[model samples]
Target: MLVILVALLWFTTVEASHCSIMARLSLMRNISELSQNNYGRPDLSHTTIVGSVLHGIKEIEVWLQNFAPGSSTPIHRHSCEEVFVIVKGQGTLYLTPSSHSKYPGNPQEFHIFPNSTFYVPVNDAHQVYSLP
Candidate 1:
């Protein structure tokens, strides 16, 4: 899975570079540039991510997200499929949302541990709840 993800990431970077000059010329990042977080959901701690955007890439955006214990995402969906790779810690992935709702109903859930990869289907509601 990790190998496949890497290949996909590389393939996407190359594919997206066709859209812009910066993306074509600057395609890498260093550890020093990352920030600690993303934004907010509801009752959870602040969502954090360390991401260097090859900003303006077509069809792909990648970020390294971290979740402190007890942090979680509100159930949500995206027009495009979203992937999550658990680089560290443990969590529960909620899946198969019951309706066309953005965040609704009892859905199936799975426990996730480090190095795991999963994706929310296009338009399917899903969330990841960090474990203590």
Candidate 2:
């Protein structure tokens, strides 16, 4: 059986002008129901839940990600701090805190289960793998 791992990603960085005074609501949809994009990685697929393109959210961007069993994301780093909320299944996070160094050193592994949360510092290289 394929264990689908669902996660919500909060990206902290947005333009102020895109902020809105009125409140907005975005309903969460099923993983298979929502549009999924691999983002250049075959093992990972993600859909934007809230952001400038969808809700004009200026403070943060929200995304829903689904990972197939035995799949893993590529080692990557970003400018903004990222937080992940795991809703189902389990995974392992490999993080390398080398924001100030020229090369990413050995990574530290952390196991993540359902209902758990993890944070990644800005520019820290990291990868997540779905456990079967």
TM-scores, one per candidate: 0.64, 0.70
Q: Note the Cα lDDT for every prediction shown.
A: 0.56, 0.70
The lDDT, on a scale of 0 to 1, for candidate 2 is 0.70
Whole-model alpha-carbon lDDT for candidate 1: 0.56
Candidate 2 weakest lDDT stretch, 10 residues: 1-10
Tell me the tens digit of each residue's lDDT in model 1 across 1-132: 111121012124244334465645445656346453345433332222212234444544555555567777677766666677676778788897545666556889898877788877667777778886
Runs with alpha carbons beyond 4 Å of true place in candidate 2: 1-34, 39-43
Q: Model 1 residue 55 lDDT?
A: 49
Clashes of each: 3, 0
What's the TM for model 1? Answer: 0.64
